[model samples]
Target: MSRVSLQNPIASLEQLAETPSRKDGISEQLEDDLRSFGCELIQSAGILLNLPQVAMATAQVLFQRFFYLASLKDFGIIEIGMGALFLSAKVEESFVRMTYLITVYDHLLRRIQQQSTHTPLDAFSQRAYSLKSMVTTSEMQILKRLGFNVHVQLPYGTMINYLRILGLEEHDTVPKKAWNYLNDALRTHVYTNYTMPTIACGAIWLACRDQQVKLPTTPGGEWWLLFDAQPSEFQNVAAHIQRLYHRKLDRQQLLSHLSDTEATLRNS
Candidate 1:
């Protein structure tokens, strides 16, 4: 029996399309900051829980939707990030307690402070409060934004289903490697610009290639199945996702960007 449950997938693009962009200029900056924070938080939570790509993706979706309605200035980035993590765990059916979630935040804050040479508690407290308030308010907003669509089908679930359909159990190294690669892909912000179906198809294709899976065709043919399964409106989304993966985003580059951003945030 599969450990994960199959559920309804989130209609994220639909929700995002309906949400009117806030008029405040700062809202854009706040969204960017919150997105960065959400990425870090999701990375941390994935490590702590040993979560799969599907869970991380679900969390990302939840975080994005929450921020879509709630302003960063009102709730604070930290609290909203934590809350998103908390809510994502529930959505993914991997429920972690709020206390443990807070502890994780505390640990993460301390680590950030140690790296930046700043006081953790003082710097993070106000932001944390803001996160809390935003989460409290945005929780409702997220539900409404989603049209109470609580089901969130993850790529991990699809991977597992594929594995089962293939009848290749017994911890195959190739599939496991492919799964990890897909999980890493989920962490990137590129998915926001593409439809989930397209992203999933691309991630799965990349993972299979990384594992040297004997695909029907090199790339295009294998993706045909995904395209057929995807909604017609998002047909072109795969092209965009493919473009993102082809672009360079090495670890060293990401680390440099993170370091520079952290320094700026601390100095500010």
Candidate 2:
């Protein structure tokens, strides 16, 4: 019920284009695709590493915030994502060992490449050492870029509290559906753009709409006014989550998209 003073970094699409992360050669579409891809990488790696959902969500927020401060062209998503997850472990107290983290990432990278190399990476090998260094360096870079302010305010708790206040907490399906929406919303940049309360309200709105569970909407102010959300913000959050389902991107898929764009540019 209390507002957290921490806020995530926010930037408009136009502002993002001007940031260091937007190099002259990279297309906005390519960057957007990669953002989604990076978040997916963090989420997948988190799950494989047996990290809690809160850690994964916090990592995604860190990954998203870093990209806003840096450029996709300048950094590899694999490294940054791993760094985010590693740092998030410390922040969230999930405490995954570096060796285990790198091993899972190695496995994930191979899977993404669809490679036949199933040989486990040796912890003493040069490659493992390189990966460890890469992740550590990225963690430092992220800390510096964000000025060591990595506090993230998640919307899950807020959503539940709002539902209870609205007398919808007892509904079996609404809470679960809304929670899923919040999870998917992390794949996009909605967290950076909207406050925690707004995101919570948006998820609730989507869930209620899907279930045909209407809330009180007095003329003086809509139901959302009880929270800190505007009706317009709900549409944007819903659209972001909807677009995530519509466009699925992985490392290889994003590379293909970039290749197609380059080819089209050559013909132009």
Candidate 3:
């Protein structure tokens, strides 16, 4: 795939930042909207493979950032999703081999029970080549649209670093359930629309609470008390993030919409 033009990545991001849409309070709801049009294609791919949550979250950020600047009409959402996943793998330092990704995709198809008569290896090779071509072309457009902002900071990284700094032992660290919820949080435009660092911290804290991690809390503020006695200081940011979670869109509802849209697309 060709790289995006070396002109300016910011210009494209500006365009994405300005697109108008109805506000759905839940992060998952917004994610469903994006997925309905194939925007979350990579995310689905990650889910099927049980790839690390960090990898999935990284892909989501890339998708949002790319869409912020580029139009979705010329390139289908599936292409963008593929490119986002490929790019994210590189960004997060996970670096799944092209062959491995292809294998995973093939495995996913079988797991989902999609009709495929080819051997897993054969199916993977064919699909990988196709996905690679699409991603190559889309990468060029994405880079041009993004003005070359390839450095995407992820919440997972931030959250882990914060936890370490707060002297939380790995055993007492953020629970898996909380981590999963935070992973979902990354799917929303919240990172782009709000203060991400603060929200990430808050999400970890909340996750810890949900799992009963026994972390201390501030008296009445939005910030939570960490083990080291320093507050994470997410008062304002936490409020917004909490509100979004409180108004979370139902997963089943989103799934129904996705199924309907996929059916329509296939019919078309």
Using lDDT as the measure, which candidate wins? 2
Q: Candidate 1 — which residues are off by over 4 angstroms?
A: 1-23, 26-36, 49-56, 68-76, 115-138, 163-173, 189-197, 211-214, 217-223, 226-268
**Cα RMSD to native, each candidate?**
7.6, 5.8, 7.3
lDDT tens per residue, model 1, 72-140 = 434444555565566676777876755455556656655754565544443346544443444566556
Q: Put down candidate 2 lDDT per residue, 1-268, tens digits, no spaces.
A: 9654567666677665565655546666667788788788888889888899999999999988888778776677788888999999999999999999989887876676677868997899776877788789999999999888889889999999999988999998999999999999888888988888888988998899899998877576787888867889887888888887777555565666444423432343
TM-score of predicted structure 3 = 0.59
Backbone collision count in every prediction?
5, 1, 9
Give the worst 10-residue stretch by lDDT in candidate 2: 257-266
Q: Please, what is the TM-score per model? A: 0.58, 0.88, 0.59
Candidate that scores best on TM-score: 2
- The positional error of residue 67 in candidate 1, measured at the CA in angstroms, is 3.7
Off by over 4 Å in 2: 1-5, 12-14, 218-220, 248-268
TM-score of 2: 0.88
Which model, 1 or 2, shows the larger TM-score?
A: 2
Each model's lDDT comes to 0.52, 0.83, 0.55
**Cα deviation of 27 in candidate 2 (Å)?**
1.8
Error of 2 at 217 (Å): 2.1
Q: How many clashes in candidate 3?
A: 9
